[model samples]
Target: MNFEEIKSDENNYLMHTYGRFNAALVSGKGAKAVDVNGKEYIDFTSGIGVNSLGYCDDGWVKAVTEQAGKIQHMSNLYYSPVQIETAKKLCELSGADKVLFCNSGAEANECAIKIARKYSFDKYGDGRNKILTLVNSFHGRTVTTLAATGQEVFHNFFFPFTEGFVYAQANDTDDFKAHIDESVCAVLIELIQGEGGVVPLEPEFVKTVADVCAEKDILLMVDEVQTGVSRTGQFLCCQNYGIKPNVITLAKGLAGGLPIGACLCSKELANVFTPGTHGTTFGGNPIACAAALEVLNRVSTDEFLNEVRQKGKYIIEKLSTFPNVKKTRSAGMLIGILTEKDNAKEVAAKCVERGLLVLTAKNLIRLLPPLTITYEEIDKGLEILKSVMEE
Candidate 1:
């Protein structure tokens, strides 16, 4: 019933995978959350970017609840109307031909890897299975994605990880070119390196990479797990670069608060997975798809996207007044606050104590406020962050 009692049960039942803040949240609406002790806090972490529409959005709740009453889940063996409509909307929005639904970012990326390797094999007849990813990239926590990840720190304790993944320097055309060979089937990239400190790639480098992929016929797979679903002020961050990728992986914000991921590819690679080639039982469940449809409807509008950009600018502008803030880097709502002296982890803990929810990416304090966050909530959260910096 209270904070202390809930945390006691949580510690006993939950795995110790995360270094949690002291605060325990209970209820929330929009960008505001209250703990069991009735303490309110501004939510800027957005459940690590999963809560795009914020906590229990009315439209999202209605969609999900209605779908739940009708059908919670159906196997892929059965046809689902909501799934079909959501897939159609995704194709229209991204210009991708088809979609394969999964449960999380890692599963979507795993599907992409399968498509790339199998496409190469089907076309060139085998041995071209390597995937090249940029350095400092974070793919996922799965065994295969962990191997595909470029950070060496993640490579340990997992003996005999998946083979055929190579790392290249980010934004370095020469380094990527040197690593690309006849065996390399695809080059997976993140437009804004979210987990690696919100680093955006150079425009010229992106253009050159696009050109190289076009010439070499290597599939350019863009990982939009954290930046997609209008989190970057665009339906897809690749739109900003004006480049068409062969495949795109999406998750995090797609289904508002529900678990859903989509791996969409061009028509050329759409047929790579025939029946029984790859699938999930819970993939494309009607309830999750219905929830995603609402999220997509709200986020995929020009006016709403513009508001995201404006609010992002507003948050950054307010943060500029903090003396300890060295710099703020962001594309839209996803932000990284570089501080002068404080450790991001410590500052984030203090933020929770001051009644705010924040996140950390490497040494930078990351902020992924709800895309539908009100200006009043933004001010509240930023004020808490400012006071933490001042202290």
Candidate 2:
């Protein structure tokens, strides 16, 4: 259908929740998408980092197609090769003792929160159910994960959010210390606050938090849902901090645009969940697992990771010189462009008009180009973004 047709039909049927953007994308090829009107766009958003290898990666498509033909899904009671293989790859990469699969970032984080609480419950009895999360952090939309998010705006309209969460200031050692109590069971953090304007947590702060968690015996959980699967130029963003977390949530790019979420825990928290403790029917479906396996195979390589780092540097270098950009911050391909002259939301919209897709995080223009994006495409996308910034 044409853009008008799609937009009209969508508005007629769909909920008006999102302030829908004007473009109606129809198809894409390797970091570039075309709208229904044939307007081409360099896709820096990558479906909000879900398309780790960009659109329609040949191998990923092949894996998904083959798996679908064989077995699309199987009940949790039955064993499936693809699911088992995906789990094996995740455990090997993350160094976590075991993993529990779910369907989205929210579910992954929900599972992590539960594991943290259950681990605490087995040891400390009651009252140690509180989870501390950093301020300006965004976890997920579920009630529990929403409660875990430290932002105030999301706390409203949903009365009586899950009550066991406490907020601590991000990177503020003093503020973090003040929020602690005997009831705290875990300290959840995002190494790089993706939704919070892509702010990287201070290394010293992470060290202190880790030390505190150890001293207090509170579980250290890292939310890598947006930063994992090689989005941050590493297998996991926590690797940059050189610290191991008790539990890490993984999603977004994990299943190559398919829905899959994994909550991995270290040896200590792994056994906290028994067979009947928790589960999900679609957690480890064969088709999603197959796509995820291919993504893992390609994204976890030495050469591919090195390229991601280089591309991140390349994008930042170009953005730093943009007319209105004040600066940029990031570790890898996850970039937050801080502009001095224009609102980031406006800049992102302008980029859409100029055939470039982008994202926004608070006042910063967020960019999550595919990990496999080439130098030529990066150059093209940057050129469009530069023009938008200057305009």
Candidate 3:
């Protein structure tokens, strides 16, 4: 169907939750996508960083398709070899004792929350369930995860959101300590605040937080949903800070472009959830697990990770020279460009109209190009972006 027809159908049938882009992507491969009108675009957004291997990666497709043909899905009652293999590889990569599969970042975070609370309750008893998150952080859209998010804007319209969440200023060790108390069971953070304008927390502050959490026995949970699986040139962003979190939640690039979320826990919290305590019917679906395995196999290598870091430096350096850019903040492929005009939304729209797809976070132009995006693709996308900025 044409773009207009597809849009009309969507407006008529679907809920208007997302502020979607004007382009209607019909097909894509690698970093290039064609809209319904047959206009091609350089996909800098990568479906919000879910396409770690770019669109239609051959190995990912083969793994997913082969597994789908064999056994698409089985109940949690049955053991899945693919799921177990995926979990084992993930544990090896992240240094986690165990993993729990889910379907989205929100679910993974929910599982993390449960693990933290359960660990605290099992040891310290009840009333120690409060979690402290940094200000301006974005967790997820679920009622519970929304509560955990430290941004006040998300707190509205939810109506009496889940309780037991407290906010601390990002990078402010004193504020973090002030927000914590005997009731706090865990501290959740994103090493690089992607949605919060690609802001990387101060390494010293993070180290201090980790130290304090350790001293107080409060579980430290790092939300790697957007930064894990080599998106930030590391298997886990916490590795860059030289700290190991007790709980780590991963999604987005975990399964190439498929739906998958994993919550990895330290050995102490590994058995916190009993068989009946938590479960999801479709969490460890064979097809998603196969795709995740393929992603881990290719993206976890030192060669690939080094390339990601180099590409990130190159991109940041290039974008920094642009006349319209005021500054740039990034970790690997996750980039935020502060436009001189301070019109991120307008700049993003112009890029989309000119055959480049980017994202906007708060007031900055965010870029989450696929990990497999080529140098040529990067140049093409940046050329379009540069041209738009020149206007």
Candidate 4:
């Protein structure tokens, strides 16, 4: 369909949740997308980090296509070899004892919350269900996860959100300690607050939190929804910090653009979730697992992960030199560019007009490009961003 036709249909049929860009993308390949009007864009957003291998990666496409031809989906009751394979690979890469599949980041976080609560309840028995999350952290959009999110903006419009969540100031040890108590079951944190302007937590503060969780037996749940699957130069961001969280939640780039969420836990909490405690019908779809397996195999390598780190450094260096750039923050490929001028949104719009796709988080321009994006594509996107910033 044409751009106008697509926009008209979306306006008439779809819910108006997204403040979408003017262009309507129809197809893409290897970090380049073409809109319905035949204008091409250098994709720096990567579908908000979902397209890990970029659009239509040959191996990922083949895996998903082949799996679909055989069995696209099966009930959780049935044994799925593909799911088992994906789980095993994830465990091997993450050092987690076991994993439970879900359909989105919110579900994964929900599962993590449930596991922490149950683990505490089995021993302490109720009243110890409060989960402490860092202020300025963004968990997910679901009502429960929204409650877990530390930002006050999302808390509005969602009435009577799930309770037992307390917010602590990020990078403040005293604030985090003050929020902790005998009633707190877990401390859920995103090492890098992705939606909170791509801020990385202080290393010392993170270590202190991990130590406290370990000493108190409070489950340390790391939400890796936007930071997992080698997006952070390591298999998991926690690995970069040399800390092993009790529970870790993953989504976004896990299935290489397909929808999938996984809640992985250590051996101590592995069996906390019984068969009947939680489940999803489409949680471990064969096709999604196949895609995830391909993604894991390709990205969970020293060479691939090292390349991601190098590319991130390269981009940050280039961005730092740009005249309009004030500063840049990143963890692997997840980057936030703060411009000297207060026109991040306007600059992003100008970028779109110049055939570039980018994203904004608050006043900063965010970039979550595909891990497989080439140096040439990076240079092209950076050029567009620089020109727009100059304007």
- Model 4 pairs whose backbones collide: none
Per-model TM-score versus the true fold = 0.98, 0.98, 0.99, 0.99
Cα deviation of 239 in candidate 1 (Å)?
Answer: 0.7
Candidates 1 and 2 compared by lDDT, better number: 1
- Candidate RMSDs in order: 1.0, 0.9, 0.7, 0.8
Model 4 residue runs over 4 Å out of place are none
For model 4, residues 43-81, the per-residue Cα lDDT tens digits are 999999899999999999999999999998879999999
lDDT of model number 1:
0.92
Candidate 3 regions off by >4 Å? none
lDDT of 2 at 203: 95
Clashing pairs in 3: none
Candidate 1 TM-score versus the reference: 0.98
What are the clash counts of all predictions, listed in order? 0, 0, 0, 0
Per-residue lDDT for 180-235 in model 2, tens only? Answer: 88999999999999999999999999999999999999999999999999998889
Give lDDT: candidate 4, residue 236: 94
